[model samples]
Target: MEHHRSISDVLIIGSGIAGCVSALTMAEEGVHCTVITAGERLSYGNSELAQGGIVFHAENDEPEILEKDIMTAGWNHNYAKAVRQLCALGPDVLQELFIDKLHIPFNQRKPGDWFLTREGGHSLPRILYCHDHTGRNIMEALSKAVSEHPNITVLTKRTAIDLLTTHHHSSHMDFKYSLANSCVGAYVLNEHTAEVETLLSRYTVLATGGIGQVYLHTTNTPGSIGSGIAMAHRAGARLLNCEYVQFHPTALYAGKRGGQRFLVSEAVRGEGAVLVDSCGDAFMKRYDDRADLAPRDIVTRAIMDVMLKTGDDCVYLDAARNIKKDIVKRFPTISERCRNISVDITSEPIPVVPAAHYFCGGVLADLNGRTTLERLYAVGECSCTGVHGANRLASTSLLEGLVWGVTSGRDIARRISKTEPMSEKLRDSIRDWVNAGDEHNEDPALINQDWATIRNTMWNYVGISRSAGRLHRAFSDMRTLAKNLQDFYKNTPISKPLVDLFHGCQTAYVITLSAMRNRQSKGCHFRAD
Candidate 1:
């Protein structure tokens, strides 16, 4: 069959805030852009799951306060320049996304006051919210905007399995044309159509979000398979600090099979939700004087410690006592989800457990969101832009995505003028990949299980706390899993699940490798070594 996909100016591999913002910026520049997304379901990316809301300095809020809080929360190791830049740019990005383009219906106090709320780790009320489902609000707005764009094509349910490259170019003159050397585009697998297609572009942006799904128990969506980071690593992009994983303090724990729990928004705590022990005693005050407003790592460990010491099934989140029944009416979405599970926030405490929530590290990128790979950009939770070092401040992931996404897109658009479109040589390499896509065959089902193995290994060894011994064990487990996955992937027929699993294997090893390098306990990365 003849390949039909024409080259785009830039092919972005996600549909969340980052990818959408990138597309918006690129389209304005008249750079033809295409976004290849994880699923047809809108806002399926982690951005839509962010309940804490986007952190930005309201005009009334002090900039120094936000900066100090972030610096202190991230333990001072985070990149000051990037963090400062992000913080400075936060309001602009927020305005661009929420007010200028997506038209998110932000709650307001005085005509146009972005009714801000407070979350853990912030000293001031700085988060802009839309009821309780902030991600949903933002996602809804962005989806509408992107779908209407003429220059931007949003390809849903298409996973960028591997980046198209020529690291070892077919022609000597091509000289390592690669996502590693320089991105040509990506090999995307469309799940609904069951066809593998080669997508070509001058720039390929990986806005693929977080890897919290690497843990057996996590708050991330099923799509958070670490595909972008894993593919980027294989394409020879530099990765950093893959070890640091953040655990949210309170997920509505309902005894899931993998101990997986539904995310109860940090905004609950931001809205005065209290943490209580097994005996129904308010306990966060005992752990940290800041109480419900403590940083996520501290909050997670505190809950875990209480659970371990009391030998209880889980702790309780007790907002029923302080928060109003009427406000619960306002947050009907969250209130009802909890109520459906028989945990009425108006009368009883919700059973809570800590679950892996965010990855603080990933494929390293610069201030402009440019990865080591030329013409390849990344934003959101997937790229370690150093704005988040060992830990990320609440609501900052989407904020970072907003700033870097726009910046990266404009830069790529400017660079597109000097670069040639997808070459015949590059297309041939991608053709070979797509041809190999049809040629090879192996057990995809077994490859799927390796993903579980990776999740189990991370959750067991490199979870909320870690030690040299545990890390070593994790490395061993990761290696074994990787070997099995590589063998399976090499021998298997090309499929979306297979590609995702192969990515998982690379992610596990990279995370383990990054974990083994860091020796101190700081922020999300806790180590006894």
Candidate 2:
């Protein structure tokens, strides 16, 4: 009964760093923006769970060096243009927005000097962190700013079902699929009331973060189920590098099931922590010269190799010996989390394993964040600006989100002032979303079973180390599972849980299919065969 339609200058999906930054930036430009989130609060995404810091340049750093590090980590498959934009624009944005404007209290070594740390694949210490919970601290500042912004509105517990496009109005329309395919808004489902609303906007941005929930073990938050990517794909948006899923090298191996896993920050390694086996023997030296400092792909593969060779469930990170004194002070969040679980970091080695951490690819966009579709843009982990290439360097995700968020926000705000609002006829033509079927999914157990199957299939076949046979099998299984889900979807009432399952399946299928297409072994998507 609460079903309705609304309009805004910009409608940003996902309340992570990218979405919040975009909204705040646009609001500053006098644009009325709306941010919709799947969780109860804006801080529920992967941004808040990020343990490592944001990457930025030091005064002595050169753009070429930063570019080289990113390209090398990505195995040179990166979009040169996007990478360059990030390298050049990131520092200014950090100073102007995060430091000067927002006044974020980043950790500092001395008065007026930032406390910088290095992560894997970076040449130097160019990362500015706030203790170990860098992302959480950043999110806290962003969330507070967004809440106080007069031109911004934040909606929680809303799930975007699909994008509203011109094609949705008429099947017989002759509009070209190129730039003519514009996104006017989105159809969103209210989780609390089970009502769907048409949220119309001059520009629609998808900053829905990563697709890590499709994997069995992930360092991503629960809300990262790939809804934006799925909805965009369904609406004919071009997605690039879908195969490049970055598995973080070290996630706390709690042997737990469901929800997000605890991340062991790469900064721990930067502080001299080494990956060791059950016998306390360091082994990364045999795999790569950089050893613990190697790129995420190399490190994750090395960990997997160690686990297989040793027949152990996980490896140990010896931070106790390397970072003994300031262990609790330097990484208070990690220390407290481990202590809660009865694992004292200062006295014992932390058990860790590789887990799906970030999605390097998504709705393909330019440096300005414009996607193939007209009036539609994507940023953050959900957008493939190609800054991350085939694999992401550590701590670069937050910076990428910040840069693109500002780019998209400024561009959208400028265009909104010049462009006319969507026509009333076209808006009316976008059919009211109806759940239709009176029947519930009689067996809710089927949803859980299918969800588990998709995650397990991706983990077993399409994970860190992939093969042609494995990819093929995963593709087939996902395709079949998708069809079954589609059938059930048509007959059941729309709900957030069901939509999340549907989106997860679509994202998994895309990843598997992309992996199958790229036969060559490269960053992240490594094929042993």
Candidate 3:
């Protein structure tokens, strides 16, 4: 086993929105924090892939309208209070960024107001944006702010394989409540050095984003391996509905997007882009009255239904006819991608497909972002805080990250201030999860094959549209996949790709299980009877 070290006030996994925000917030309280990231850069997460802006109900916008829109998108089974909290606090946190934090730069909108872009679902314009790459801009702002803070340390190219636990550390201390005596630290692998090390903290936050890359195609970054949620599940956290995965209605058709034709944001549709058939015919009107502006669940299903009938590999999102052709300046990155990839907005339609985008279910948590496990707080996509329900409305992601990141940080600050640092025994317990230098099976091909099976199972059965048969098949496939991986993982040496692939495979199993258990057509989880 690798040697472990127990230190820090808080240890954060996944240095995206939640991680950055939480680190900065806690540092303000004089608490020293360490952030272990899975990539070379801070934004090397699903957060940077989001092209759309965030949703916020400002003074001019009615909160009830936002609530209704989100509830409808989530299919009404959403956590009402939590969703309401999101709606209530969203605008305030946004206001804090623009007004107090002084981050936003001439936000593109009417003078004295923030730019409100429309997306797939909302009846009114409630999205607060900073051009097309709102997520990147937001992450950059938080990352800059956090990196400058002395109390917070950012460890890049460090992937956290599993969470460190007090119970797992010592024999006598039965860590029944992980939060109370929980999360001593985490097991981190330095990608550069190719060595495993232990990181300990009073509080551990899993800000890891979506599991889109579990499929063959996704807008998510390849690093989005469901690390946090999977690690939390293994640590005895009961996961909620993991099946409700949202397939973005407008991902550029590709086997996998490593920064190529990643996505044409839904805001393009909101600006009057239309969905056209292969015959150059507009078809969305037949699907919904809102047509090009319909909610994501409706539009995605319509796209699938149309494709099924036509036997086509893809559908076209026609941006040629609208004044939105002039609006291409708003999305410079997308425009360049379109130009290089044989698409001209003024002349041709963009080929599109519904790709797995976000996972709405995770370790269930309350408003304060505290999970079932004590001392283990979750925020952002890693925690199923009941905000998204079955489907997440466009732009609510950054909102949750900011809100819960701060809230959870406040809880962490209180914990660290109240208690003494962990004992020496807890530090020793963390090193056991890592089998350092104990070389085992070295076949990369075998590990890759296991990963392929997992991805194919998720894409085929737990995909855009699912049914009882498909869900059952997916469950069975994932069960087999999980069992196979258990052996492969025990035997394989610890490599970054293998570790990421391993976590993703386990997450796929939970998602498939969640889909099979929730036998209803709701939001992104459509069950074709």
Best by TM-score: 2
- Over the stretch 290-381, how does candidate 1's per-residue lDDT look in tens digits? 98888998899988889889998789988777876365755667788897888778888889888888888888888888888877888878
Error of 1 at 210 (Å): 0.9
Worst 10 residues of 3 by lDDT: 253-262
TM-score, candidate 3, is 0.94
Candidate 2 on 246-314: residue-level lDDT in tens? 999899888757557899999999998999999999999999999999999999999999899989999
The alpha-carbon lDDT assigned to residue 427 of candidate 3 equals 52
- Model 1 score (lDDT): 0.80
- The estimated TM-scores of all candidates read 0.94, 0.97, 0.94
Give the Cα lDDT of each candidate. 0.80, 0.89, 0.79
Q: For residue 522, give model 3's deviation from the true position in Å.
A: 1.2
* Candidate 2 TM-score to native: 0.97
Span of 10 residues, lowest total lDDT, candidate 2 = 170-179
The clash numbers for all candidates, in the given order, read 4, 0, 5
